[model samples]
Target: MVSSSQPLASLIGRKILDQGGNAADAAVAVAAALAVTEPCSTGIGGDAFCLFYDAKSKTVKALNASGRCPEALTIEKLRSLGFEGDSVPNTSAHSVTVPGAAAGWVDTVDLFGSKRLSLAQILEPATELAERGFPVSELTAQFWKRGEQRIMNASPNGHEMLRHGKAAPAAGEIMKLPNMGKTFRALAEQGKAGFYEGRIAESIVKTLGDLGSTMTLDDLKNHSSTPVEPISIVYNDQLRVHECPPNGQGITALIALGILDSLQSKGKRAFLDAGVNSVSYLHTVIEALRLAFADSKFFVTDPEKVHVPVNELLSKEYLAKRAELIDPQNTKAVAHGSPANSSDTVYFSVVDKEGNACSFINSNYEGFGSAIVPEGCGFVLQNRGSNFNLDPNHPNALAPLKRPYHTIIPAMVTRMDGSLHISYGVMGGFMQPQGHVQVLLNMHHFGMTPQEALDTPRICIMPEEEGRSVVLVEEGIRPGVVEGLKALGHEIQVVTGLMRANFGRGQIIVRREDEESAGGHVLVAGCDPRCDGIAVAQF
Candidate 1:
């Protein structure tokens, strides 16, 4: 079974499965296809992360395929450029980082893929889709329209992404990305070297250099994806929730879940009894997430460059302590606790017949990221480097060859016995972890099916600004619930119509063991209504 934010991408993945490829291979195919059909959000010129469940080993592993700052980029350079601020401008060339999605795709296959399919075979489907052209879906076209101004203003080659160098494509308009297809063919034939060591790499350096960036060819040539240990906190002992460790914010969901469970176990709040979306349930969830974000904002950074106390943060003792702060009646001003510390895009899950699951996310951070397109590459450079802070003493401060705090993450859940349970993720900038917690709980605590879990309304705690707490409440929640939140002194911004995209586009595929079937497993999946996507199963 395969589920993704783009319909064609999902079908392409299922086709890989039909060709006898494993979950890892199918995931690569989907990632490539999304880049072609949804260019405003993802492409080879971005970063990717994956959590792969190796059923044979009964273990889940993480792939941190994020790229780093150029070796010459530093706070001093930005200061000299006359900008004095906490973060670089989102679309500036200075914000572009080494693209990692290309390397990430190849590495994921090499590590977990079945040997039955070659790299060329795994990528061929996406390449064909790009070359032959495909109609733009409604949601994808909306996002593409949002990127029009950036693409036209940020790079000389940006016009390639627009219709005849003038406008964004409308829904149902057929779009062809031949240059992207050529890039894929290069990758298929030469592997990682095809992207990092040739014309593509040169074009990347030239594009950035032309815009006053310090990036060089060596930055791209030296790039490689990292394989790290997957982190998790067993949720109420019913299931283990896994995410890629620090630098990605997946830990935020685990921490929030831990706090809620601690509250329930302490007999302070009966969450299930509170009922989904009730005042008690909503208040408790908002407070716990506030506390979780406080800690995450301070502690999540590149682990290779600084210490992130993962174990101390997720400790039951710490979670219980944090749980003590939530009041049943009001919102609280939250700050990072002492105990620890730890985008536009496509999130998809693929579970093969063998029960090996791959939960993957890829993004060009903040649509049309950096908006700097390499000549002939047909993709935008990611503005991921904009995530870095300017405070020299901070762990996430900008520096040479260091990664910034990353927002894109993939997640997986497993039964206590270590069997694959769910492969899922939500795609949006800061809304990801919040979406993760909400969807997982809908299924775990409220007994919602895969589709119901996604259909439920959600709330997002916008990044704190000027010490104010603002929450974006999706429209589906009852007005009484909104009033209940506002009565609690929480600043509520009701989001409706097209603006609700802020909630996220999520996908899920659950592996259910069925005693009645000879194969013994049934795949159940769902795609978010917010996206033009679908979930497909192979017969």
Candidate 2:
């Protein structure tokens, strides 16, 4: 088994596997290391969800470690302060949510790890780098330059980091955060308690309060992570699914799969070719998302407080009803639904020699999160609070200790024979659900390799708009395909080079029927690629 992403993270995963760690153990190690090296995309301040496939048990399990809104956050309080519940400011102190990453990382390792590493052992690399600093990547530097001014105005600490009066740091410049180092150290030494109940919590509360934020120590102390059952749909005798219940949009992926399944069963192979059928399939997928998303927006709130009849959501009847809304020959205009959640997230997957596999996704809503870097902490706090509607009547309205609608989702695919097929995830805000569906169709229906499937062109329907949309056709898609799609009444947008942002960064590990595992990286898709990521296989 191995890891993907930067060469360093890939090397770490291989090292863990070399040291006899199972897939879960190797994933944990790679995840922890990536939290530091890929800070622009993810960190400990975010939340995580994982799907695991255990070959021995022939069972799949899901771990939901998403963050919750501060318990003190209530509609009455926001109203008292003249804040509109439906229009909560994006960067306000009130937008901060209780961080769930620390708990998630620890819990995942505890539950599935065999050769478990201590928190310090897991976090040592990140802590050292945060303390000493590392050179910024060119992409990160570009975001930094564009975002510096806005970040500075976000919070006082933000200004300190961006050095408000100065220019943004260049690509090779050292980016350091001693405060984040201290926070990681505390977490390493004390685990979850260090971040949730002790001095670390105290500091977070104080810093938030100082910035006129509403989060309190009680919010941190009372936070807990819950496990939820995953949802699945059978397509071509294969199970395609993701975690269900509370704060995740995995259902969106299921809905897309169901739609594809219907199209395929109807012998609609014409859509498999790069032409009108492709555009038609995209339109149907988007329409399905629009309808399903409406329910998610209205009914999918904190599961502990709201009884979401998940069975109803995933039932064949429910999916069938939703499917009936799709038009086989036409495109539908869709709107960007009310913002469920928006964050800069990352995804990674792993499969080991033991036939064990894991698919994980993590995020800090928006880049640098709330941009509220507590003194001595290298990481930014999550602004998951932005996911809550200010409208008191909405199920996802801001309530004391409620979890906002989360976007991070991890997915798994298995053959009908109970053989694990793929552990994968796509990283983007609302684009995640759409990406999941597209990739699945690319693999199962179109019969493309994982790399080719991920590398294919993609289209995203505006969540709230009905007919208007943005479609990204990768350079590889045939020109005739684009013309055919445009003829189908889609507002096509062409992107130069690769279509990274419009699509997503997809990483996957596939365990073939022979029990041989392979992995692939999302970036560098055009280069010489292999299935097992940067992993060295061992028999």
Best by TM-score: 1
User: Scored by Cα lDDT, where does model 2 land?
Assistant: 0.67
Instruction: State the lDDT of candidate 1 residue by residue for 300-343, as single tens digits.
Output: 88898889999998999999998998888777677542111014
RMSD of each: 2.2, 4.0
- Kindly provide the TM-score of model 1 when superposed on the true structure, using C-alpha atoms: 0.98
Could you estimate the TM-score for every candidate?
Answer: 0.98, 0.88
Q: List the residue pairs that clash in candidate 1.
A: none
Clash totals, every prediction: 0, 31
